[model samples]
Target: MKRLVFILLLVFAGICCSCKNDDDGGCVGVDCLPPETQTGENTFGCLLDGEPFIPRGGVNPLDCVYQLIDGERYFNLEAAMNDAGFNEIAISITTNAKEIIENQTYSLVSEFEVGGVSGKYIFNGDIFDTDNQNSGKLTITHLDIDNQIVSGTFFFDVIDQNGELREIRDGRFDMKFTR
Candidate 1:
């Protein structure tokens, strides 16, 4: 009986180990968290090519960068791995926005730029400002003007410099701004 119990225990351990090593050793099956709904604790994550993309510039409590210039508002957010080989995933939004409110949807225009870059910027090589062929929107779901906390969801399809169309989806952000 003792030998039988030990064998069963070993079998259980093997099953557990296998369950945890799903290809990339990340969560497997439907239990894995979707990137759009994964934002908690003032962090950001999204899906690119069905893989998890989280911020790599260290987990910042309030890393969402914001700026106001000439009656326009801009927001920039990014994440990357520690290695230089990894491309930094980033998004910048520009608006003639004033008094941000919940449920405000802004269409991302191709001509919008900040510091010489377009509004719908992507780090994926060959991809530039969202091509004129597509349109994107940024929706503000929550705004705490007193605390300066903001939450939003966005997605865009942009053409690369080579004329290839790329889709970025399931994106979400919750951040606090200084200004």
Candidate 2:
């Protein structure tokens, strides 16, 4: 079976990696990655697409699972919208991450799911170490923000629905705001 073969391959790969014969060999094992380069933005071409994106500085997937912090403003930029009005109105976003509007502030977390690919990401969310895609047909049910009505344009990197992936990058939506 494919599963059995995959498991055997992994076992062999692990053994070969531990062996001290990698300096020059036929099977180099799972490319020995640097300590800090084990997992990177989706651009790195990762098979397992889980959250906590960077494992550190970046917004851990856990944060996305929490409730949007209270007191944080959630303005409906659209005066009113319906199924026929999605994305037609404007939405301005401003976070307290910065002192004023002129400063680069907080980053919004957007969930993406389609064609067997899913993951939580930012505007230019890279799919690891690859030039997957940052633009795709958007389907938004709400637009909460603060300040002007949708200021700058928001960007998104869409995964290649038909591209290769080792993991299904699905995610749970639970965004909370904090000060």
Candidate 3:
């Protein structure tokens, strides 16, 4: 029955090959945004003006900093991406608040000295930031100080020099921090 065995093997191979999953990096439907994960996956993504703004390249596509400034704890997280032409686009959240705990929502203000959070967006040499008039919120979903991992979600609106408001939404990041 050698002939019969050969035919069965061919069928099995074809079935196995067909069962291979074609996953496009955890994409879901039309919006190919990365899934929101609390684990330290080092992922950063958001929707900028309704388009996907996922950090793609650079020495550090995703980075976080936790330090003490003048006896006050400071925190900063930055995500950057280089486009096809090498233009850098970045988004950052910073705060010098005394404590950064989980499940806390912070307001994104313009001034860091005012004792609140701040958000910034840089694109094509233009810098936009949150101000009293244009602001947003950042919610810390997970924070592990000993392990140096942090995960959060944020959204903000910033005004450019031309007074054009840019919207950044559906943002999420999970990464390890450095001191």
All-Cα superposition RMSD per candidate: 5.2, 18.2, 6.2
Candidate 3 lDDT tens digits, 1-179: 99999999999999999875843464543266777888888888888777778876678777789787677788888888886688888899888654678999988886457466888998875777798988999999999988888899999999876778888899888888887
What TM-score does model 3 achieve against the real structure? 0.78
TM-score each candidate: 0.64, 0.19, 0.78
lDDT scores of the candidates, listed in order: 0.57, 0.26, 0.82
> Residue 147: error of model 3 in Å?
0.7
Using lDDT as the measure, the top candidate is: 3
Candidate 1 lDDT by residue in tens digits, 79-138: 443325665455454443334458887666554444222335456433366545676767
Kindly list the per-residue Cα lDDT of model 2 for residues 61-126, writing each as its tens digit.
Answer: 222111134533222111111112222211112222222222222233332211111222222322
Misplaced by over 4 Å in model 3 are: 1-30
- lDDT of candidate model 2 versus the reference: 0.26
Off by over 4 Å in 1: 1-19, 22-40, 57-62, 82-85, 96-100, 111-121, 124-127
Once model 3 is optimally superposed onto the true structure by TM-score, how far is the C-alpha of residue 123 displaced, in angstroms? 2.0
Clashing pairs for predicted structure model 1, backbone only: 56-80
Best-fitting candidate, scored by TM-score: 3
